[model samples]
Target chain A: MTSGPADAGEAMGSAARAPTGGMPPSRDRGAPTEKGTATPPPGTGQAAVGAPVITDVAGLQTVIDTLAGQGYTVIGPTRRGSAIVLAEIGGTQDLPQGCGDSQDAGTYRVTDRRDEAFFGFAATPQSWKAFLFPSRELLWSGAAAPGRLTVTPDPAPGKPMAFLGVRSCDLHAIYIQDRVLLGRAYTDPRYAARRADAFIIAVGCSDPSSTCFCVSMGTGPAPSAGFDLSLTELLRDGRHRFVARAGSERGAAVLACLTAPTAGPDDLSAAQAVTDTAAAHMGRHLDTRGIRDLLYASADHPRWDDAASRCLSCTNCTLVCPTCFCASLETVPDLTGEHLTRQRVWDSCFTSGHSHLSAGSVHGTTRSRYRQWLTHKLASWVDQFGTSGCVGCGRCITWCPAAIDITQEAAALRVPAPHDPAPGGEPA
Target chain B: MRKLAVWKFASCDGCQLTLLNCEDDLLPLTDQVEIAYFPQATRAVAAGPYDLSLVDGSITTPADAERIRQVRAVSRRLVSIGACATAGGIQALRNFSDIGDFSSAVYARPEYIDTLATSTPVAAHVPVDFELNGCPIDKDQLLTVITAFLRDSKPDIPSHSVCVECKQRGTVCVMVADGIPCMGPVTHAGCGAICPSYGRGCYSCFGPQDTLNTRSLAGRFAFLGMPEPAVARTFRTFYAAAPPFATESSMHSGGGR
Candidate 1:
């Protein structure tokens, strides 16, 4: 069951790079627009500034190989059982080709797109959090003797990682996480180390799922920044090509190794057209205008009761959210009482113990727990990180067993509650 | 060192086995606490008063009822583990039927059998400090409870539904995706959403979560085309006698159906 790095390398060599006809006629064309560059939105992260280049499917393999050769584990989306999951990959074959996902509130299914186009799918269940803030990590281990205790931090991963096919919303999620884990007053050393050492190759989302609201969130359909390289997949005129843009010095170096032609205006327009189509086809929307204030003000809104009725109080929404970061510690001692190891594992606000105090949990009821989660994600997070916690990835909607939509809930808060004819009186 | 003991009554030894299943934590745990009286693991029984007592199974007989009281008196903190000790286990399904008729049919000599008419949780017989809800409690959670006891602090066992674990594990919901009926919304989290990850709905191996909305979840089951009888059957699975689940199941059972 274990796939070695060499197997991935061999698969890359064989599956990718098959020469196909219908390469677009090359013509002299200037850079299409500012959108084509690796420059990110202002104040997001380090700007990735590089020229956009057009490359065929085979050229993309070169990018993967370059990173793999540099001793970085290349992690990408792959078909595992019935769903696409993030896993280590060696070649383009590991990518979920000719596949797309159908997502709705409380539903997700993998379907064939009827073409060999990679990056056709929407969000996978697995997010980049798996790479950055792992579910379980050993913090440190301690050995104790009479009147003495020695402790050592856990060893960091030997090889850094290169994440491939990351979407725009996910990039924003990573940014939000950076603010939470590393940007503020406190920084998680392990997360900082992993983030600093890793490379990110983002893919512009061209096929947004019904559960997607990234366009409304203004995070993407097309990534503006926070990547070493950004790619827009173009499949037209019986040809499959990718318009790759480098976002960093390292990205430019990697692109330089790939044999790609200078993208013509037609190729650039075609790529832009794909993103435009994706933007127009965004399946969901969220009205963020004054959302924070509205949520904060409506503490007594009856919608909390309505949502809680259907909400299982399952922490799935927080767990699948790319930016939600909460952890608890676990201590394990060896049989001799001489050795003890402390570990950190993911925790969720919906859990009873998450808000446990001297007396009991603060938010004990399901209604209160759900309210706390939604308000924090939409409102409180803005105050904490100077940005909304939700990147509008819509994982909360798709993974929710009860099909409770955050957009609907937020919208519900805006409508004024029906006034009771008399306080504590029965409806007239 | 803190002294810990494990006791079992009338049910499967699955919950006790979960403690042994913690191969990595068990040895390390022993370093901090002495395994005072775990008959399943060793014959070397250490006498109480014990620092902590983890009781498994349900009170099914008069003798078992008396034993729990003695256990509660001896242990400083008595915690119930698994669905049986917390909510009477799957055997509580007999609460809906005639126990006398059931005993006569199963036993060669019904007269010789001395059993309570109802299978009841240990909490019904004695004041329990805490309860770990699961058919066979999760090993990781059991470790948490044990360690918390050693430290004289509260264990951080989540009372949220299985949906949270499913989300954290990035497992798609089987109920929503394939129209499968799941108890994930009302069942306590601890199994790590194992069934749902495998593309099946939760069977509620963990008992009812805190403030469970069983009516709403049952309504969803009906909307998904599950019959009333099947909906009732689902709740009556592992923790049939649990208050919330019992009440919800009876609501759909159509009065003695």
Candidate 2:
């Protein structure tokens, strides 16, 4: 199973590959690290690994232009009504410039950052999943005529995509989904095809919202790996620039086409400082120390009831969660009774039909449904995938009408269960 | 091919329009199921004993109550579409008041009018095989129900709240963030969370979910500074007569057992 461009080098050799050098390839940079290790390696400009380059606002625009010139659809965060959503961009003018967002539990508002920083926003309502695994897609078409049935599969993504302004948490989320859709026992052909052809332009988070907790999840504030090009926006004293590093040969080739200068020591330090500040300023934290065991042991905890009291069972947590990958099938037939089409759509665990059985839905109670979701995300996901399902992007918290916080719920599970006294025993 | 029938009672015909609005799939859907009894689409009407029936609207009149019973008896599988068929629609608000007063106020001659004291769901009059929740049911969901019935499979209509759709669409919660009182937690899904995505709270047009905790949501609305009357009024919207919502509204309004 191919994980990224690194694993599929021979297959993607036709495209630009990572240059061979003494410095380890970016794909190997997925090694897990602890807190306080967010700084980039020392040395600046051409001396540093992959030779980090410094580019101004125009240079970044040129990168967008270059990707467009290469026949790639450039997608970035832009203003859509009151929220900032990821959408197709024609040029740099389409990016969310001089804009940021304020996010809290069950609260989200687009605010002017009052600066010229382009990648100022944190997270959007839509993720890169919309491109790779669309909400709705036709699987195949079938036609039957006089005891003969013919089926034709749908074609894969036609145009390649250059996803810009992807945050570190979202980058990790993509990798997690990659493991589910591609690196699993059964590969999803559509997902694999889209992932192979798409180019990722990951941006480090310099402005985390109040709902963000990537630092605790060890997924963000700074990108570790799995990117074609990683960027860190540097805005100071009314001047804006970006520190760009090539993680692959394709990324280097694209950077080579730009007229940006090699990053100096000051630029590198400034970039490092940006990520460090973000890491320190994380708005939320999840102490994952034995979180799996804590949740499993607390299945009958009273906190589930408390959570259920406020819980709407709306499936919001699962839907916004980038790692939740449940789906349902839909079949439609033509009026002639000869033609039919099967489609796949996004499904949520909170839905009663998700766990439907012949007798009835397995998770009939709100408490049971909430328990199942939490247990799967924080505990059982480790058994299914080698990693946790949550990337701590905080979309679930901000999008929940009830403002339910998963981290808070998990933390609440840590509270010691009430002692059940023996019969006739005194109450504690 | 399976014979399908579409019936209506007391509604705006929005749910039927949703079916017609499936411009791309309408032709394909016609091929799968024979339109045995759809007045909105065709002039021809086929005899009953249909394989499936999609009934929209509510039983607001004594005549509608008997009509629904007849529709149920003639169909093998009957699925209710829209809030009207599932939870009595916006007209159900009259269930709390005297129908005599309503008839006298709205009609020129109360003696000529013939109406029921309350509006109720299809299930109240007949046994429904399935219920698709929405104000105007989502076309995709409606198609799924019909397809499932044709295949003799369980329909995949979710009984969860609207919060799921809002989260999937990445819509910021208007209730929690803006302090707007939203019924998304207690309301059913299928509108794809359109209101919240447009910066508005859910109006519960799809009706109450199967496992609705109306009392808890009512408490939250009150905690969010919604006045007692507003909290009661919130539950008395589209699906006001739905049991859970109805009970909660009455409890908060300090009236009725």
Candidate 3:
């Protein structure tokens, strides 16, 4: 419990490297994206369990460089267009410094945080899922001859990835995805291959956007588990530093290579205070208590019709959700007449086509499709995956063109409409 | 080889040019289909009863209406290609106003111009086997249609919204993050979401999707500060005659020209 699991260091299979200054002149921006060391998580980043080490701004830069130098493609949150999106970052120079965001249903705008803290923004539009489970990827390619068809399965993508500034909700979303993809029934080798080589450096959420409800979900203002490292950026009186914790030995190894010192009591308290404030200021909240039962009980409720009236059925909600993993395979024959390829592309339940079978869609109306998505996400997903599909990151709400807040919609389902005879009456 | 004929009505021949754009790919395709009567590609003209006809525009004139029937009579499978052939194109804007007024505004002599009072899709006049959607239909999709026909299979053109393609291509939603009024929610998937990828809102060169709530999307556009007339006009463009879009636009079009 004290500095993670006792066997974590042994699990790393290698001793830590001597500390480096990680200063300029040695800063290589050209270090391509890749990953190296892997350490299994002991799932401990709690103050009650273990104390975290605090480091200065230069230390943040060191972490980036060291990760990059170790052949990891360091993906970090940065200002892209009007939102902070994850992209390949070589160093701290690529971080979203002095930039925060204001988010509401169907709205997001990058704001001047008016301070020089990296990772000041809320959750990004595109999650880490985009990298781990891409929207489109080649499944296989084949060439057909007169009597033979030579098929070639796609190779796992090259280069391991190190994600910088991953959120606590996003980390949970990743785990949920792992359960779905790497569960007992079947394993997606492509997803497994990508996930095995990936490193997570989760940043604690000290600022939740107007659409955020991670507090209500109890996922965090700070990560409890499932990270190589957890970083809580603290900008105190003329002091900008991070209270960093190693969730796994690989994270500890990365920290050992940086010129970081063990944190004093003051730094740990300061870090705690940041998360404490964030926990209070959650802009949105969802009552998850019996949410699945509520949804299951409200199948005949007229609320779905109200939602369907506003829903564009554009697949934006599912696409933005990091946990909603549904894909469609398309067979593409080449102009060469001999070559053919099958590709896996992202699909959503919002589309009637997603339910297309028997030469017709089972869910014809928007009301039916909306009900399927809502119930499946909040209800059946728990039955199937043993967990609620929503991490309450509020991506679905923020990215929805109709400004349909899932939290508000979920709450509304509990209340009976005036026209309805009862909550669970005959279908409207 | 199967004979392929490219025909035109009131279009700018952009969709026909898309076939030419497939320079390298077209070479092998040429082996399967004979380019019998693509007047734009060659001075070549074949007699009646073509294997496949690619019609690229709306039926705007009296002569055009007659010609489309004759083309359908000859062609084995009639594929309506591009926005004009599918939804009456941008030229269909004249459908709203008096054709005399539009002719007077553009033509030196309004009396000299030969045009119908309304430009309507080829489907308005005759049965189309398949309709390829776009202002200038994507060459790849056009090829897919032609290739499918050559194999005697149904063309694999999706009737899904442009948002599906946008998300698949990993183009960040312009309407969501930027608060821009985008036509992507209702527009059919084609053009691979080119406009949003370029940081511009989709102008909906490809017609409306089969499954879309235009009324709901119109509400969103109005919320994004697009005036009722502007919202009406947005749906009216490129796909002016597509029923759902035209109906939605007509609801708001009374506010302005």
Local accuracy of candidate 2 as per-residue lDDT tens digits, B1-257: 78989998999999999999999989888878899999988889999899899998999888888889899999999999888998889998889889899889989999898889889999999999998888878988887777677667777566677876775565656775567788888887778888887788889888887767787777778767888888888888888888888888898754443
Pick by TM-score: which candidate is best?
3
lDDT of 2 by residue, A1-428 (tens): 10222222222222322222212223322332222112122112342236889988788888998999988999988887777888899877888888898988777788898888788888787677777777777878889898998888787668988899888888777777766565543457666666766787889898998889988887888876667788999987767889998866788888898867899999999999999999998888988776766666777788889988888777666777777788767567643547788777677767677777778788888899998998888777766555677888998888776668888998887776577332212322
Q: For candidate 1, lDDT tens digit of each residue in A1-428?
A: 11111221111121212111111111112222222212123133444455688998889899999999988899999988777889999899899999999999888889999998899999987689988888777878999898998888787656888999989888888876766665543456677667777788889898999989987677888887767888999888889899988777788889899867778899889888988999999888888776767777778878889998897766778788998888767667644557888777677887777787768888888899999998888877666556677877888898787788998998887777778332212311
In model 1, the runs with Cα more than 4 Å from the true position are: A1-48, A420-428, B1-6, B17-52, B107-112, B138-153, B167-170, B176-178, B254-257
The residue ranges of model 3 lying beyond 4 angstroms of the native Cα positions read A1-51, A419-422, A425-428, B100-114, B253-257
Docking outcome class, model 1:
acceptable
Q: What is the docking quality class of candidate 3?
A: medium
Q: Provide the TM-score for each candidate, comma-separated.
A: 0.87, 0.84, 0.91
Taking the tens digit of each residue's C-alpha lDDT, what string does model 3 give over A93-203?
888899988999999888998898898778788788899889888878899898998889787678988888888888878876766665433456666667777888888
DockQ of candidate 2 compared with the true complex: 0.46
Model 3 agreement with the true structure over B1-257: per-residue lDDT tens digits = 78999998889999999999999898898888889998898996878689999999899999999999999999999999999999899988888789998889988988999889998999999999999999889989988888789778877677778988887777778888888899998888978999998889999899888779998998988888998879888888888878888888889955234
Candidate 1, A8: how far from true, in Å? 37
